[model samples]
Target: MKKLNYLLIAIFTLGLATSCDSSDPAIIDEDDNQSGTTITKAGLITANETWTADNIYVLSGKVVVNEGVTLTIEPGTIIKGAEGQGSLASALVIDQGGKIMAEGTADKPIIFTSVLDNITVGQKKGSNLTIANVGLWGGVIVLGKAPISVSGDLETKQIEGIPATDSFGQYGGSIANDNSGVLKYISIRHGGITIGSDNEINGLTLGGVGSGTTIDHIEVVANQDDAIEWFGGTVNVTNVVTYAQGDDAIDADEAWSGTLDNALVIMGADSDSALELDGPAGSAATEAGYTIKNVTLKGAGASSVSKYADLRDGLIANLQNILAYDFGPTSVVKVNGADSATELAAGRITFLKWEIVLPAGVTSVSSLITGANAGDDTKFTNNATAITAASAATVGANTAVFSWTYAKSVSAF
Candidate 1:
């Protein structure tokens, strides 16, 4: 028995040695040059290289994206969070200048899920996967050198919480044309919740990104925090979905100037607001220069809530052409603030051609749109040609000017 144990130990050591080949660039080189590198274990994959899943690839630490490189993840690749045990772990971090091209097809989307043992046949279970579930397993953070509001001198402001002296978090140095690659047909499930409240990360956090960033056709499922949080970026996105997130489905703050179109958020029953926008009230200026259109938010909870908008101390929001349904009895669209007169005069919460379908005991649409110039219609639009009771098209189509051929049933949570 002693000899057998010794043989097993020898085999294990040999496997470890093989996995730790210093010559392989993916495992050893932090610069992310993958000319002659081979992936053996959980480590960073340089940009412009293809990564295929051998087993379940667990990211034990931060995954950095070097400049001028593109990280291409093949279809059906499953990236898992580390066991975490007792410490925080970040699954993937795309630094400023690096690009991630995780392009998956509809048939086989890239899945990032938890590492649980129990298996259920049909029920969806809560993921043990989170930033704080173990430790600081932060979600993907993308930084760029685009213009960002600085609290101090240009030399003193940290980029994405990392010091300016650090190369690992710096990207798009001096050069203006830095392009973060495309992310399409990717599903990030059961993420969010890093170190603690302040450090807790979201499914996808864009910090100081630019218009060159490509974001489309992404889904975030059951995240502990917001599904997507944007902090001062100019990236435009389309065809995004957020499902059962613990906090706001989409939280935008810090002077974000992005565009969101064709968004579908199916909130959890107990979840908070579907959309939240705060501006300088939390950090910088009190104005948002973004555009939101063709959005459908359906759930049993509140439709939308803004902390700064109500306080009249945050950024101004431009919400157009939205469809919200099945908000619970207590749900409402509230805008309260000290400077309510000035904020409303600026069309901060303007509603144009919006429709709302409520249950029996919920508040009326007249009460919701009390002091605003939504459109020609003083009352909330109901059951237009787009949203009929008999057979309805998807929410995505209703928000767009063109009609969609594909039909989907809209149900309350």
Candidate 2:
């Protein structure tokens, strides 16, 4: 009887220790995905939070910063996305009314990549992935309350690659100066995961993002879709470098009335164009046009470039001081049909000071631009002037500003 009482007393003492412990419930059998510290962000972030540089964050699936909340990321922080497809795809979404201050200095740019990457803390590049790797995960998405010219002149539209049933997918409002937050010195790589059939997200998607947002010194590498695509809104961007994208390097849609300055586009063979500019789909913001200047568009050698640029959908643009090189003879910048050519003549799509190193045996700079309409042959170039022959290095984007980019480290340019 005395020995049994002693056993009960020992069990009662152990119960007190167990009730006081504060760690997470013990796992039956599990190993940490990564060494040191890893925090998995899943579902929605409902409160203001900060992700410090000391910890690595993993996006489990469809992580969102909910409305009216702010999520700040420290410089040199590394965020990775888990691999999945369809609705299960992982991405960092700053939804409408939410904000993210992802501010990184050039010396310590915030890196967003796939969890499969072998990169660890205090590292910029992983050993396993290369410039050719792509579509490993979904990319970063920023949605804000800004004007968008959608079909039927709707004030809002559902963002692409997201289900319509999701209320968080809606973007656009009347606020032209709406502030989404800041994204600077950020590098997004090996993303563009497919969320649906033939629908892969862009490396950096700005949907109805307003001018109050700050975007600069950004780099996007090896995305399966467009590196950066603006679906309306008036966000001015600066010093952007996109390399090895499977689609257009820069795409503007739905009356994006903003300027893209000092941009560099290193195109891949699967890319449709280096710059794909689209016009308004609705009557609203019909007069709004985009300005693209000081851009350098490079193509893969041989017959790999389908076209230098695709200017269609009645886009209004002021394209000046641009350079393109390393393209094949068949490649040309096209203006769709004659109505678009007439629109070009009316200054809806203006071109100036284009310096192109013509393909081997191809000499005329005007020959590099084409009009698809049988009657509009050569008329598109006739309306424009200052298409000259020159070396790309003499003008166009100052590549030195993009030295902090991962594409530069990999010599992708």
Query: How far is 55's C-alpha from truth in model 2 (Å)?
Result: 1.3
Write model 1 residue lDDT over 310-361, tens digit each, in one string.
2223456666667776565555554444343345556554555555665445
Candidate 2: stretches off by over 4 Å: 1-35, 196-198, 286-288, 372-393
| Tens-place lDDT digits, model 2, residues 1-413 | 75465456546644643555321111111122344356666666778899878767888777788889999999999999889877677789999999999999988999999998988878888899987889988899999888998899998888887778765777889888888899999999999976666466889999999999999999998998899999999889999999989888999988888889999998887877888888888876557488999998888876775688888777788887678887888888888665567677676777766767778877676677777555443444553333334342455899888888888887877
The backbone clash count of each candidate, in order, is 18, 0
Query: What ranges in model 1 sit over 4 Å off?
Result: 1-48, 53-55, 85-87, 117-137, 150-177, 281-288, 301-313, 339-341, 369-413
Q: Please list the C-alpha lDDT of all candidates, in the order they appear.
A: 0.55, 0.81
Q: After superposition, how far is residue 251 of candidate 1 from its true place, in Å?
A: 0.9
Write down the TM-score of every candidate.
Answer: 0.71, 0.88
Native-vs-model 1 lDDT? 0.55
